[model samples]
Every structure is written in structure tokens, then in C-alpha cells.
Target: MADTTNRLAGIAYLTVDGTNYMLAGDFAYSVSKVARETLMGQDRVHGYSEKPKQGSMSGSIRDAGGLSVASFNAMTNVTVTVELANGKTIIGRNMWTVGDLEVKTTEATFEVKWEGFSVEEA
Candidate 1:
């Protein structure tokens, strides 16, 4: 078995339209498969297949700094590239849209959520 303890923190980031965002602070990403089953006959045997589907990415960033929430808020569609802690990268390829944006004045931070038609690791 692989040693889980060897894992270390890596860069978590997102790029929209070739512009880098979320270079610092805490962030997370996840991808899930969309699947369906087809019944073959009265016997109830079924064939199953799956494919990449819509995904979500969320995280919080401390200090607004140079980050622009307005740009993301006005966006209807965007291409996002996310680098995970494990050194894997996922590219949304113009299928993503910013879903939510929240700014906390007391904490001087902001959080964002993005949802898309599909997501794949590249």
C-alpha cells in the first residue's frame, strides 16, 4: 500500500481565461462520474456505463487583495484550470460557470463556488 503520510501540501489554484486566481489561501476541488444503466431483458440484467459530468470547486480566500469578485460574478461561462495538492490538474475547458460568490467583511475574506458541464484531469 502507498504511504499516505508522505503526502505534503501543494499549490491549489484556479485560472480563468488564462488569468490566475486563488493562488493563496485554502481551496478544494472534486469530480464525480455520471452513469446510467440499461436493462437488457426481462431477466433484469443491465449494462452500465459512466462518463465525466458536472463538477464543483469551492474554497475560501483571506483578504480580497487583488482578487476581483466582480469579474467572476459577471461571467456566464469560463474555462478553469485547477491544480490539486497531489500535483494533478483538472481543466474545465470552457464548460464551467461561477455559481456563487460570498464576501465576509468581518473576516476580510471571500468564498466562491463553481459548477460546470464537465470536468476532466489534464
Candidate 2:
């Protein structure tokens, strides 16, 4: 049987540089491999080849305590830990680099973007 659990319903949070930032409304974390393909000369059919390249993990967090803003302004690499609702955690090495920070006055919130490498589930 296939597992039909709604994992998204579980709470998700991120800890960056020892500061915990909870999801404000939405968040995204994805890893994609860069691929290159080569096509062979075709008699009747052609074959394709590909290779996987280094991938990255990126996402945004709701800047609750203004710590994320400070971190970004400092231009520092931080350790990241993502804790999911189902008790699984994704940990990243000290390679996380802070990116753009969006501030919305109407919503009274700040959104911080981060990217990192060497992430793994634990």
C-alpha cells in the first residue's frame, strides 16, 4: 500500500546560526541536479547520455525576531537545520549563505532567502 500521509500539514521550522525561524506562511526547499545530454549519431535510433552535477538547497524563512536581517547584513555563512513535523530533520553544513531580504510593511513581516550545500537528512 502506498503511504497517503499529508506531510505538509506538519509544522516546519529552520534554525540558522543558532536562531530558530518558523515558517510564516509558506516555505520551499528543493534540490535539483544539473544535467547535460549527448546524442549519438543515429542509424535508426539515437541514444542519450547524462551526468549529475552538484545540487543546492534553497528556501526562505519568515524573519520573526529580525535575526535573519542581521545575519544577512553581516554577510556570514551559517549552519542550518530544518525540522519537519514528522520528526525528521535536514541538517546542513556551515555553508549557508544569506540572500535577499524582503520587507513588507503591510504584512509586517520580513522574508529571508538562504542557499546552502552539503545538506542531509538525519
Candidate 3:
């Protein structure tokens, strides 16, 4: 088995059916403050713009079950919410076909980056 301690902040790709997908994105415990803050909404407003904008909202990754499992089934659709420390939640859906499940892990955390999904507005 892979030690999984050196995979921090690395991204893994999974092949689902005939499509290539991101199986997971490992978020390191040592993630940059900017990234953590952006993911957690501690920092918002990249700078005010008079024009309208389209972009991802700030929030943290959340799950009702939390981070317990390391692998997910192929041809599966998973919805995981990243909850900002501020209590705001962003939902992401992963739709994939059945294939060899892949993951990138660290001693602290692991992730399956799901492709073919969209982020729902909070």
C-alpha cells in the first residue's frame, strides 16, 4: 500500500467510463492560509468590481460523515458540501461512471476529486 503521507496537496485523476476525471484533490493539513481562508470564507471580496462577476464562493469542505472513507465506488454520484468556518455551505456534485477508483491521500487526509459535476450556488 502507498504510505499516503507524501501525497499532500497532490491531485489524482480517475478514469470513469471513457471520460477522464479528477478522482480527488488532496487538501494538505499544511495548506496555505490564503487557500484555507478562501476555502473557509475567512477572507472574502477579492476586491470590489463595478462589473458583475461569476466565480466560486468561499467556504470549507464539509461532510455529514466527515472524512472517514478513502475510496468511493465507480459510476457513483456523490454530493459533498464544504462548510465555511463561518457556517456558509457550498455543495459540489460528482457524477462519474464505473471504473477503477483512485485516490490521493496523506497521513491526515485524502480526497477523491470528482469530475463531471457542478458546484451549486450557496
Candidate 4:
């Protein structure tokens, strides 16, 4: 039978250190490699080469005291975990924050993103 739990409920959360934060917006993650063409053939494309898989995640949290811009900036060698409603989880180790956090009088929220080694499903 097919699992349709995800269609019934939308729930995803981010865990940094030991704290969990419900994602304010959509939580997006990706694992990809940098592919390039190898030696070119005479007329057509030859082979291809690929680097290691790169993993990253981007999401926003409601402006709160759990994570401040200064605290997130000082993080290093951290583990990030994402839990989905479908009983799926992905983990990223040694990930660091590489974000473009901006503050405005109109709003207090800040954007967050993490990039590091390959993500592993757990």
C-alpha cells in the first residue's frame, strides 16, 4: 500500500544542537554533485566527471530567542537534522550557517541556510 500520510498533514521541523524549531516557511534540502565533461571527443561529448555530493538546507524560522543572528553566526562543526511528517529524517554534520540575514524595522525575522558535507538519511 502507498503511504499517504504526507498528503494529510504537513509537518517538518529543524533541529540544531538539541533544540527543535518548526519551520516558518517551506523547508528545502538538496544533495547534488558538480558534474563536468571529461575529455571531449572528436564530434560528440565524451565522458563526464562528478565531484562529491554537496548537501544544503534553507528555511526560515519565526523571529524568536532560540536562535539569534549572532549565535547562528558563531556556530561551527554543528549537526543539523530535519524531520518530516512522513517519518523521514536527514542529517548534515559539520554544517555551518551561510546566510544573508538582514534586519529591518518593518520586520524582525531573519533568513537561515546551512551548507556542508553530504546528507545522510536516517
Candidate 5:
């Protein structure tokens, strides 16, 4: 199952007011537009159109700049711990700031092990 397609894709057309959250089995990414069918006139003339929406893909990792977010906006000096189904855990610290990742998620099992340092405005 580890090598299987155990991933999820989702979009978060985020704004200053709301926060969108998605739980995926694997990796997540964002997209530009969403297509929809529109009708016009007396006839149900359906047409495809685009909208400002988000999308997720399997085995896709996005960067923060791609998401149009600043590094300072995200958490800094953080540590991550990944736990596989085999009951083994892998820990990484100072890997990158939150601003480095466009999308980040922590599963119920693989928790944020610890934090060594944090960002501060000087």
C-alpha cells in the first residue's frame, strides 16, 4: 500500500476571510481554473468555462512562491516527523521554512515531532 496511489488532490481558493483544508492520502497541489458547464437561451446549450479554483494531483509537490505566499507568512524553524505504517519514524529539522512549501499537511499519525527555533522580527 505504500507504493500504491494513496494520495489526494484538492484546491483552496483562499482569501483573507476563509481557510480551505483538504486531507489527502499522498501529495497535494493547486491549479489555476475550474471548468463548469453553463447554459444559455431557451436551449440547454452547455458550455465549458473556467473559474478561479484550486486543484490537487498525486505525487505533486508545490512551492510557496507558486502559491503566491511569503515565507514569513508561514511557520519558520520547524521540525517534521514522518511515521510509516511499519511503526518507524523519520525526523527532519531545519529542513525548510513554511514559506518553502506551497502546501503542507501533517497526518494524525505523523506529527510535528518538535521545534528547535522560531522566527523573530529583529
Candidate 6:
């Protein structure tokens, strides 16, 4: 039997400008911040400052998700929301696509990735 350890089951959706698209398999996201740096001064460590945080989301489009390269390229103020079956919600706001999307017909997969201004978990 296969062991199901730490498996995540969820649904992810994207709202570009104002349109919403339900995502398919391989959905994932992450949040990160700049590495803390130690100030170098005359004597020793001084203090730490605030660092910018970044969020990213990636997923495959469901069949007939109605995603268009023209519209995606012109997107502004994008947002992505993921709802896990574990009763957790992750929201990414003010996002933009990182690069051109790649569509593969063999497996009916359309991959998309976005970098966002912030990520909120609730």
C-alpha cells in the first residue's frame, strides 16, 4: 500500500483583473522575504530593518479555463486564491505573470506562474 504522508488536497483559482479561472493539477504557491542582513559598522552588529516580502503561485489550467495569452499579457492587479481541504485559505494579491505561458497539447496542460506583492494565509 502506498503511504499518504503529508499529502495536500486543494483547489486553486486565479482572478486576473476581474476574470476568474479554476485551476487544475500541480497547483502550488510560496511566500518569501529578503534574507536578513547584519549591519556592519565601526564596532559590531547594529540593527535589522524591514524586508520586502514576495509571493508566487503556479498551476495548470483546467480544460476550457478560457485563458488567453493576449488578455493575460495585458493583465493588471492580478490575484490568486487557494483553498485547501484542511480549512486553510491562501490569498495572493497584486500579482503579475513571470513569463510567457507554455501550453502542451499532449497532456492538455497549460502552465501559468505569477509573482505577487503579498500573500495572506487564513
Cα lDDT tens digits, model 5, 1-122, are 25524433232221111222222344222232454657565776666566543222222223333333343245344333333333333343343332223345443211111222221111
Worst 10 residues of 6 by lDDT: 9-18
Question: Which lDDT tens digits does candidate 4 get at residues 62-96?
Answer: 66655566777776678889887777787888888
Per-residue C-alpha lDDT of model 3 across residues 50-122, encoded as one tens digit per residue = 4332222121122223433333444356554443333334454554323333323332323334434344535
TM-score per model over all chains: 0.64, 0.63, 0.32, 0.76, 0.25, 0.66
Highest lDDT scorer: 4
**Pairs that collide, model 6:** none
The local lDDT score (0 to 100) that residue 99 gets in candidate 3 is 36
Q: Specify the poorest-scoring 10-residue window by lDDT in model 5.
A: 108-117
Where model 4 places Cα greater than 4 Å from the true spot, the runs are 1-9, 33-42, 104-107
In the order shown, the candidates' Cα RMSDs to the true structure are 5.4, 5.0, 14.7, 3.7, 15.6, 5.0
Model 2: per-residue lDDT, tens digit, 1-122? Answer: 74637554557787766777656665555444445676867564376677764334455445455444665646346666778776677776655455556766665456555555456677
Q: Cα miss at 98, model 2 (Å)?
A: 5.1
Whole-model Cα lDDT of every candidate shown, in order? 0.67, 0.59, 0.35, 0.74, 0.32, 0.68
- How many steric clashes between backbone atoms does each model show? 0, 0, 12, 0, 1, 0
Give the higher-TM-score candidate: 4 or 6: 4
- TM-score winner between 2 and 3, please give it: 2
Q: For candidate 2, report its TM-score.
A: 0.63
Please identify model 6 stretches exceeding 4 Å from their true place: 1-19, 36-53, 63-66
Q: 1-122, model 1: which lDDT tens digit per residue?
A: 96646566765777777887645467666667675556576787777666666676666755457767776677657777877767678776544446566778887667776677766777
lDDT (C-alpha) at residue 104 in model 1: 80
Runs of candidate 3 with Cα error greater than 4 angstroms are 1-75, 97-108
